[model samples]
Target chain A: MRGLFAARPLLLWPAGCALLVASVAVAITIGPAGISVGEVAAVTVSRLGGADSGLSAIREGIVWDLRLPRTLLAAVCGAGLALCGVVMQSLLRNPLADPFVLGVSSGASTGAVLVVVLGVGGGALSLSTGAFLGAACSFALVLGLGHLSGGTTDRVVLSGVATMQLFSALTSLVVMSSADPEQTRGVLFWLLGSLSGASWPDVWPCLLVLLLALPACLGRAPALDALVFGQDAAGSLGIHVARTRLALLGVTALMTAALVSVVGAIGFVGLVLPHAARAIVGPGHRRLLPVSALAGAIFLVWADTVARTVLDPQELPVGVVTSLIGVPAFVHILYRGRRTA
Target chain B: MSLRAEDVSWSVGGRMIVAGVSLEPAPGQTVGLLGPNGSGKSTLLRLLAGVRRTSSGVVRLDGAPLEEIGRKGAARRIAVVEQEATPQVDLTVGDVVRLGRIPHRRAWAPLSSADEAAVEAALGHTGLTDQAEQSWHTLSGGERQRAHIARALAQEPRELLLDEPTNHLDVRHQLELLDLITRLPVTTVIALHDLNLASMFCDHLVVLREGRVVAAGPPERVVTPRLVSEVYGVRAVVSPDGPGGRPYVRFLPPTGEAR
Candidate 1:
């Protein structure tokens, strides 16, 4: 699947994209409401035409309000997170890089929990705003620490670890201090990344982030390719390595923050999907970015579908399924790496 | 185009690593930068290639300061192959070589036919055309070095800078690599540890000691036994050898008295 197809990357990408489209279509047919693909398609087509599908109220609400937006949100978060993963890995020049490696998710969780505990902004504190601010704040701390540590690859990762631990401790402290059990339970759900609150509003910002960030990523693929050789080599190649790293890192962080604020932090779609995509398309970011995005969308759609139906009326957080899958996938990567070495 | 460094020095934490050093080979000549470990050969090469800004003094490319020349403009004319540049990713040989064309290609444009031709030509020059499809990790050490040279050739630059390009090659590959380098129609500065190879292939040699240029001239003139003994701090005999009568170095074992 990896080597033979790499000779024809152009041919492989279209196939992967078609698989994503087909998977999203099939995934929408899932969930406890038992909507069929035909009904899903009819409602989607009628909605696109600004007309009603004339289905029964229960099925229409299931098709439109509950399942469709959640499925689309899953696809959006998956694509954005995966793209961020690709960027972080290339910028840091480490295969272990992911969206949460710099403590963005921890910071977001802290912001969300702070909102839940303190009841800030006179009850008008949207969790996303607090989460974005928290992400920005944590990123600043990580950068400051990384800079002081000379900004080496391992030093940056170490700084991220510090930031993550500090923010996680803060988040837990807030949860423990909260007087209301209901608020603490809500914070826990968000921390574990439940897509149950997915809605039409959650879909647009993610879609907007994707629309702006994906093209930016595509345009920088060549520069990112040069960076795989390291900063000195990239500088010799006429790429302003420092500037490029900062720009791409900012773009990836912004997009990842947007997704995390919406979907809480979906882990493995960003971590594992890029490696799978790199295996298929090779390390060139031009092909890896889009293929990873497509594969991520497909992976999350199916995972979320399983999350909705596996327990039957008692929904499991999608993060749990992703981690369950991600751990084994990561082990396989390590096992393969050792065998090859 | 010619490249020159005027009293270049680099320092960090208030300690100078490369002191005031200056050398300029005649344009299109093959110049060898000869020094032992910690003598600052690699540091000087980086300064000349504009990969590092000198703490003091200037690097001139065709009489213009390196910083004023701009990175893209310098890259179009200069290609650098640093020591110990092992790619962590599993890039194919072709993929790595195609990267040399980046300085010449538009940001989003596909590789043009000229770019493809240059890459193929570089592969042919470095004897890597047959291995273009092979994954980089599968290559032998000499092949990896040659692949990097092929990448430098693909840049189609007017000047090539290589830091210890022969550290991984065996005897025959080393000879072939130096032969190919001497034949290229570009200005070349190579940092080398092998005294004999430097004397044999280099048209001119610049010897550095403690971050300073101690001697500079044609290999036969500058590579004397006394100069080698003084810079390297060991006894060595130098004699003219081969058809071209280039100086050859023969080292004597260290004497207990010296120790």
Candidate 2:
């Protein structure tokens, strides 16, 4: 890995691309029905204009309508969150910062919960819209607080923590006051996060947002790198530090809101995946962002698959599975960081 | 490149730190700012570097108002190495030096060949080539200071501003670092507390007392016994060094009346 990073990064790009393809194939194959590898490939090929096979319509529906969309959503959400985490960590100069650290996830959850429980504008809008709005509001609050407290790292973290707690309390209130038992279940499931409702329609928006934001994040990689040195030094380098940070936060928030609306609050993927990627590759964001994204996508897809298959006929929440895996890994990384420091 | 500050004054909280201070550093000349601790030497360096805006004066680079040039443009012209910079992450020596190229890079572009060459040159100039791959935390105090210098050097700047570059360096490394600064082909302004080192390397001297310039001239003209005694409140003997004509100051034990 060291030599791979030391040499031309163009080499690693191809390997990561190959891994992404393989991971997607594996994800599409491993599910509750236990389709054969050949059948999986045949079904996939047939769907993509290959010759017709013995696969039934049910298998086709599962592969095309359910598994494919869910896998794609996982990949896109994973990539987006990981990229968001990388940028946030660098911008804040704090290793612990993730998309949720700014209370974006809580904001998203509140929006989602309101829609699920209270109903929005007489069903005029869905939970996704509320999630976006909540995410935007929380992001704006964090930015405002950061400015108020001199835009320092401590200020950002404090604001994020405060906003997170406030929104979380509100979310809990909404969930607790629900009279219907099913409504509580819906809110609880959404909080735990899943791709169970993922469909083709949900895939396009996430794909679009991820595609647009990823390149922009990559373009600002040098500026992000400069930020690791500190704001004053970055300012001296003519980085327009505040403006760049605001723009990045806005874009990341938008991506997070979109993903959270789809999968609910999938934690740890954003917080831990970037560190894993950084440990493998160096802290250079240009390579770090994409690799982290790919790794994150691969991780979530497999985690989601395990959540589905862990107890057949009853799926666990994907967020629960990811947290179970991510927390230990995150702690291990922290331990290593402590040793190194 | 001449840096001129006119009637520059700065106050923090409610106390004035630098008041009505004016000075100039000519192109390709090395000027020393000397003062006791808390005499505003560091503040003066900060003002000259345009890191801080003065409350009531103008600082010009090459006769143009510093604000006229944008931050990045000013950065290209003036590079500052502060007294203490301890980054949290464990960046390699090469990584730290590459940061100096930030102002020159476009938003998306990778480090160009020219940029890489400049980094290499800086590392070579600072004699840190062997330590390029080493983590910054592993370096000695003097090595870390040199790494900071290499970072500033990679900017390829026109004027170098240093605030006590030798603060933590040993005597040998201090002399070596000052020697390297003196040999650079650029205007240099440094805030220093070591009178002998300043007198040895600086072409011009500006002595400060209580946020004001007490004396400004060549070392020979500025480092007199009475001048040192009066400004520093210490009895000192001053003598000509050699035919090379630099004044060398020898301190006498402070008498009770000296203060």
Each candidate structure's TM-score, on Cα atoms with residue i matched to residue i, is: 0.95, 0.89
| Model 2 agreement with the true structure over B145-246: per-residue lDDT tens digits | 899889989999888899899997889999999999999998999999988888999999999988889999998889888888777888888888823778
Lowest lDDT 10-mer window, candidate 1 chain B? B82-91
- Could you say which candidate leads in TM-score? 1
Weakest ten-residue segment in model 1 chain A by summed lDDT: A332-341
* Highest DockQ scorer: 1
| Stretches of candidate 2 exceeding 4 Å from the true structure | A36-54, A178-181, A331-339, B6-21, B36-43, B52-56, B207-214, B220-259
Candidate 2: give its CA RMSD in angstroms.
3.2
lDDT of 1 by residue, A102-129 (tens): 8899999998877767877667888888
What are the DockQ scores of the candidates, in order? 0.68, 0.50
* Residue-by-residue lDDT tens digits, candidate 2, A1-341: 23556456887788877888778778888866766667767887887899886778998888888888888888888889898889888988887888888888899888877887888657876888888788888878887988888888879989999999999999889888873788888777877888887998899999999999998898888788777668766766667777788888888888988888778888889889988887777777777888899888888888888888888888888999999999898888878766457
Could you give the C-alpha RMSD of every candidate to the true structure, in order shown? 2.1, 3.2
State the weakest 10-residue window (summed lDDT) of model 2 chain A. Answer: A1-10
The global C-alpha lDDT for each of the candidates, from Candidate 1 onward, is 0.86, 0.85
